[model samples]
Target chain A: MTVQATLKAPGEKLIRIRLELEAHEVREAAISGDFFIHPEESVSILEEALLGRPGTQEKLLKRLQDTVELGGLELVGISAESIASCALKAYENRKGPGKA
Target chain B: MEEWRLIIDRPGRGTYNMAVDLSILNSLARQACPPTLRLYSWYPPAITIGYFQRLEEEVRINKCRAAGVDVIRRVTGGGAVFHDRELTYSVFIPLSHSLALPSIRESYGLLCSPIVECLKSYGLNAHFSPVNDVLTGGAKLSGSAQTRRNGVLLQHGTLLVGADTELMFSLLNVSKEKSVAAAEGSPEGRVTSLSALLGELVLDGEFQTDLSMRLANAFAEGLGCVFVQAELSEAERREALEIEEGLFKREEWNRDRSIRPAFGAAGD
Candidate 1:
């Protein structure tokens, strides 16, 4: 797996993880930040959904946003646009289709 | 009046079982129905790890592949558990339900009290250990995990009516030094069985039935609500199938994405 991160602001970052997966499952994941989300238990929910998943850039970003949103994470400085852009770049880098 | 629902589902594969559990949880999140208790089993024994555990660390993929055991990760958190010949139970309760206990520890205690009581009835001293485990003389006979979201709480556990501990140790990659060190760090105790404890006090089938009854009564008393026997709603079944097809049964979701150790052999 290859991962990339683009920081949008303090307390917010967009991470794009390119997984070498043949199917649509999330096998593993890791999230680190300095913030608190309500109910503390929501982290477990996010972990369950993201781990062991196979997804394209758009789908993974959407799922991650949905998961965090469902768990009531406020999308402060990190916007969906940033996440998508970061994911697309990461995917391109992983593919190495452009720059030699 | 307390109504108890009994469901004895046909043995299904492990992924299917997990799909059903997730479906039930999703429905509960949607406020679809009353809290439910389900009793089920697996066809071929499988190994399920926690949601957060590293797949490489917790499972021996080559061993599992060679031995024909299915490996999957669960939606709940805890250590890895081997599901074989064991009675698995799950409970999904809406968070607002009066019966829905507050806090993880309280809920685990409430859900597992009956099992402990049933064990005592059979002359074994079983108690709920902290952080969600049932122990008898420090040996874990049952282990459970829980996940709460969208006003629904799903808790599931395995009762070791019987198991192959040696095979469990081997197939779970417990041979590695890190695994051994982790095991050593854990509270040391051997696994125990109901048959071993009963000493002929109860027949196998009767033991299962009696335990179920005790758990039902405990839930009724704990939550002050009735449990109606129910089957999977068509919507739930549909959701489960979709999730299974899209996630559980997929290879990328089941493997890969592991941050393999920087040192050691390539495969390790």
Candidate 2:
């Protein structure tokens, strides 16, 4: 099933996420935010790396950290940690309309 | 140290403005142009999203069109900005230029120092708010973006003279809480303008009265670089037109991947 969520962390970037879960991990995902990232083209690259990762903050953080450490991406106005957290927030929000 | 070529331009549409900046950037990259500083305004106002931003997520299409606000993408990376009642400046210099510095973070502070000083010339205390914002009295007075490519760096920013909180907030998406704050007056509650800060300093509240000349002079003094007043060369104008037609005018180019996959894409 397709899932979606929106998040705005005060003093932080605003993110909107959509995903299709496959076997618990993400099958397809799109992450768009008001944040700025250098090399602007690496946005999709980072998103691609996030796909198929577990839909949890810890797992996503580890994955994001690794991808960033690879040295191809440089994010501004936001960070990998925030992205990971926002991704989890999106996932969790999608799971429960009443809870989030 | 070379004297910078300073060009003051009248208000223009978003596409043409971006095209000129990019053209200057390209020329600087090739060493075919001298280090330059441009001061310009936007006609009918406009919204320029960061280079990587997904336009639909950041802007309200109907609101932008209804208000006659032009929408275009910047060659630099930053958040969406409402370019109204603002003095927008762009600087193009080689990476090896003395002011270029060794790091992007350092360069932002280095480049924006001129803005801070310019605000100071107005007798307002402005300081560089790390990462890339200029602030005074704890309120943001300016914000900037940068792009480094082809051995050159381009930095551009806007200093608010008179901000229309309602129009800007209307064309942008914000969190519910922030939206409420904006409705109350002032988006984010942290942005202020020269007019607002200097309520009685000038007779004209718009702050556009001789604002451009004041900024140009302040910037020249602050950067310690002399400005040789110049107009766009024929080559620059031609290049800008080429870029305007080839990229900025194309809907597909401006709206790339801005929409959610399920909902598809739409535009101005």
Candidate 3:
């Protein structure tokens, strides 16, 4: 199932996440928004790093932080915590068998 | 005072404009060109979307094509902007320069000070809104975005001389009703043009040239630099053509946000 989430934190720009999930794992992810990230390519790197990860906020946050440190990315108006929160929201909002 | 090259460019298409800026940035990074301040305008007009923005979600392509407006993606990150009735300025400063601030947020404020100064000179009480915007009278008057490469930083911004709220809203994928509200200066609308603030419908070539001159003076004074009138070198022009072909003018690059540049990540 594919689910999406949009988040606009108080001091950050809007971030929209599209998560493709199967069996409680992230198959693919696409992140887009008006936020600024230096070297710009770090965005694609972030998305690629999310592939095959567990669809949980804590794990996603760790992965995102690792990617940021390894990539030396400077994110303005957005952060790893916000991104993970949005991604997890998408996973929880998935309207598949997990729904009540 | 430090000397910086100043180029007053005539109106140009969006692809050529973006290509020229990127080419100049590369030149500065290579230490092949002096720090430069370029003032320019768009000829047929265009909308430039931010680097991370989804093009289809932000723009109406068919409507733009029907209206003869060009759309391109900027390397800098910000909201999409409609380029018309505005004076655009780009400043390229190598990190070696004494004026280059060490942090991105501070650099935006430093680079944008001149715009606020110019607006203040016009008696508008304009101020710099951090993270890249200038506001006056509770509405935005100018917005800027930045990209760094190698050891150089490039910041470009637009100062609106007039506003075409109707046509701008039509081309953008935004609520139609906001256009009327914008013209009326409703609280929901946050854009204000020079003409609107000054209570004059000033859209003449002479006015543009005057505005450009005033801005150039303001930048020189604010940055503690002297402007030496100059033009792009032949080699730089050639590089711009290459960039136009390789990046800015490509349909795939314009439409797809994920298309990486062949030259690799900037600043790497």
Candidate 4:
């Protein structure tokens, strides 16, 4: 399962990212951002949260929200709506029509 | 009294060394081996990344590959470290042991006291830095990391006897040129060598041997035990091979440097 999003600022290029999940833990994640914000620490925190746990859309969103809030990171130009929508799409894709 | 097993292994590759350490930790967890102390070295200097460090940002992969340096990821967490011209030590303690120190900091302090004493015996003022580093004159000469699982703790570190600082800088991502300029401009502290500490005592291999013995003895005495020289059991060797095959060799564990891209990229 995977979730992806692109965040862009006015007059700036878009930054794309994809989060792939496996067995409830984050298997691999890739990010290409127009602005550098030290993505490694954030990604690690996400990985730690996903490890050996059940990966659900709500759980994943909560993990990211909690980490960003606690760390006091600036989401800046990132679209929160896009993130939630992408996560839901990925979750739905993984669960299929009957399951969702 | 509890018996401490000592293993002095010949020079091996980095993967083998990590395998042995993990194997020892596993064996201790299973109560198949007594608390053990291992002294070993790497044949080709290796760059080991901490469990959490981004491989790309932490190591210069091309430089290491060109120099025939093996890169491995450790089960412990810390910054990346280059292992060359240094003695590596791993100590495993089971939770059931009466003398087992609680918490990472306490265990580091307890185990490193002997190293401090040994360095002092050689006329070098070495001190243990909080959170696991040994420094001389406020510059790190050794750094350690620990991992606890299944009631067993594995603490390991490098003792820099002699190192190629130029090569180290080339292999690591350290901004040495900038740091040196910064230091010259402001006199900031930097890494120091064991030879610098030994000064006139350079030619004395006997002193090094004595220091090693003293550290082993201190650990044994501190824990109310006798040191027993031993080799790896068949089970340990088997388990080590299995772990190496499974976790250590996996790209997901070692090369998946993407866990934190915000920090840096993956090492090639």
lDDT of 4 by residue, B1-268 (tens): 7778998887778887898898887777667778999888888788887764456656788888899987788766655778887778888887666556655557778877766776776677888876566787767777777766557777788887777888988887753432553366422226676777776565576655655677687667666788899999998787677767766666666786432211001111
- Candidate 4 versus the native: TM-score? 0.68
Q: How would the candidate models be sorted by TM-score, starting from the highest?
A: 3, 2, 4, 1
The DockQ scores of all candidates, in the order shown, are 0.04, 0.53, 0.50, 0.04
In order, the Cα lDDT scores of the candidates are 0.62, 0.75, 0.83, 0.65
* Model 1 lDDT per residue over B110-224, tens place: 8887667756766778888765678887677887877676677778988787767888888875424334433665432357776666656445556666666666666666556
The best candidate in terms of DockQ: 2
Error of 4 at A10 (Å): 35
When candidate 4 is compared with the true two-chain complex, its DockQ is 0.04
lDDT of 3 by residue, B33-54 (tens): 7899999999889999988888
TM-score, chain A only, candidate 3, equals 0.86
lDDT of 2 by residue, A28-95 (tens): 77777666676666677678766875556777788888887785666766777777776776666556
Is model 4 an incorrect, acceptable, medium or high docking prediction?
incorrect
Off by over 4 Å in 3: A53-55, A96-100, B175-189, B257-259, B262-268
| Candidate number with the higher DockQ (3 or 4) | 3
Of candidates 3 and 2, the better by lDDT: 3
TM-score of each: 0.66, 0.86, 0.91, 0.68
Q: Write the per-residue lDDT of candidate 2 for residues B70-163, one digit (tens) a residue.
A: 7887767667889987889998888787778867778888888888877777888888977789988877879999877666788899988788
| Per-candidate clash tally | 13, 0, 0, 8
Give the fraction of reference interface contacts each candidate recovers: 0.00, 0.42, 0.62, 0.00
